[model samples]
Target: MATRPPSLPTQMKAQFLDAFNTSYALRSVLLPTLTSAHDILIKVDAASYCHTDAVLGAGKMPPNPPSFPHVGCHEFAGTVVSIPPNFSSPSSFKVGDRVGVPGRAFHPCGACFECSSPEGPDADPPGYSVYCPHSKNNGISTDGGFREYAVVDSRQVAPIPEGMSAVDTAVLMCAGVTIYAALKRCGLIPGQRVGIMGCGGGLGHLGVQFAVAMGFKVTGVDNADAPLKLARSVARGATIVDAREQEASEVAVQVGQEDGKKDRGDMGLDAVIILPESQRAFDYGVGLLRNHGKCIVVSFPEQGFHLSSRDLVFRDISVMGSLVGSNKTLREMLEFATKHNVRASVRTLPLSKLNELVVEYHKGEGGKLVIDMALPDEQS
Candidate 1:
């Protein structure tokens, strides 16, 4: 029998959101040349939709003004199909590597002060995925992880660590590393109490787990009356303190700590990770910290919070902003999350279902919604 010709490879598809044009379209786009820059070209087995991505899709996001028709999703985990022959970085792995690029501080000038900074480039203390002064985000300027394939710098790529799956690793780049880095900045010892102001979203849930794994007791606070069950699942043994004036549970800590003068612990509770998408969560987080306590703000809301200097001054509390964990931290974080077996509660949807999911996300509440490759095809 005659051999059939090899099947023609199809163009990759990406979820593009043109905010200025106000359109949500997922279509095939041209792949960039491999010799351009960077080491690995990844086949995205999993790409996660962060609240930041959703906000940007709706034109409510921040950072630089996105060039029109940007590809979507930054949190990524995938298999590396090719590595340039000239690739020389001593990364954990080379081609055929399964890796995660948690998206923060992955700017491309790399040599500039703001890009390199005192903190390690890519990730602080030496991590992956830095948005350098000259760098651009995936799916933002160039195509991002939303496509079937993404190419990133070896400096921005790290092995997904043993014991974690691609589905889980996708968020590890952004949401997972964000909280992990914040906790590290807090510099709390094992047993210090940490308050999570928004305890029930993608970032918040992971923050609770990471905090618990670091040996700090987490008190996850959320405005939702029905968050304990979900928070308990993530925090696992940590307290779920309702932000509302709900009478405290027998094992819960605060009944109305919001009303009371909740100051930082004497030895200090280390840091406070606030993931609320609202302004009040930040203000409330500041109130809960102890003297010299660190209130690390994780999310960016529509309007910045209105904080009082008096509250900051008298308490001797320090408010620090955290990006994500560094490449080194990403490696350490996988071990940390694995040792603790911290799993994210994810709702998987397809690329075609993205719009529906985003609408749902903006309206009601749910766990992390991961974009899987196996969606019902719409182009057919």
Candidate 2:
């Protein structure tokens, strides 16, 4: 049996963006209602801040941008408040269950080649459906988790593993699954060398930990000393390189040579997951790969990258892009994180600070911030 909310509010407070590049304003709005049998209502507990939210709020998401007066947040966790009488959810989900609504917020057709294939040529790549034309991005196409309550698809919500804090689960919903899918698609084997570009970021840190968990010889490359230190602390025996001090290419070459001398005798890094959006980072990641190695681009960069067709053909280096993790991958990632205790370092703020924090995030002055909606009212 699911626990019902004590009282559903008719109107709730939410952060709304009325125009592009404008500050979000806290406004009282009607609570969202579930219109589908499979839909569920959630009272938000915690929501993590994402750079994507900042970018989308600024109305710079390219040709198609989110509609105005939108609520912006994708990574969030909450408790189930209501389930339709005929709604069918996973057996594990019950009313009052702590749940997480992460990156893949849309429902798939379930009949498309990408959705139906399983580990075959046509199988949807891990986390691939988030980009499907039919998919509706929560924060963009619909109202998202920036408010006291949200209406979400049953398939998009996962039960947070027991004993995990909602704050931790909030960050994991996006960063954890994104990196997990990228590494999975890399097809790395134990003892193979792998490098994480931008290892100190919200997503980079998780990439390092997951690679290390998979028994890959991991190298964390980042420009910031603080993130490097944090990465090193989390991933034991992993190599940390400060990209600011030395060229990423040089670091990769040194590690590759040393790794080749080891008993496994691999020549270069098996793959490099580029976690930053800088063109230079992508270039360095390609440089780090050995012949026939792969590069997974997981970050969003506004600028275009220059790739020499000749260089690509001669080197046999494979470059691919990963958006978000799929439902299957999301489940795997959550189990893996719980089993291996992979957690992100986060700073919690009351939802009241969302506006102020948005400003600070735009200025680039914070680590991973999880908004705790449970805090006392402090709206500005």
- Which regions of candidate 1 are displaced past 4 Å? 1-10, 20-23, 105-107, 114-117, 120-131, 225-227, 246-270, 375-380
The TM-score measured for candidate 2 stands at 0.90
In model 1, how large is the Cα lDDT of residue 130? 60
Query: What is residue 335's positional error in candidate 1, in angstroms?
Result: 2.0
| Candidate 2 residue runs with Cα over 4 Å from true position | 1-6, 89-92, 107-131, 261-267, 363-366, 378-380
TM-score to native of every candidate shown? 0.85, 0.90
Query: Against the unseen true structure, what C-alpha lDDT does each candidate score?
Result: 0.68, 0.76
After best superposition, candidate 1 residue 157: deviation in angstroms?
1.5
Clashing pairs in 2: 2-95, 3-95, 127-325, 127-326
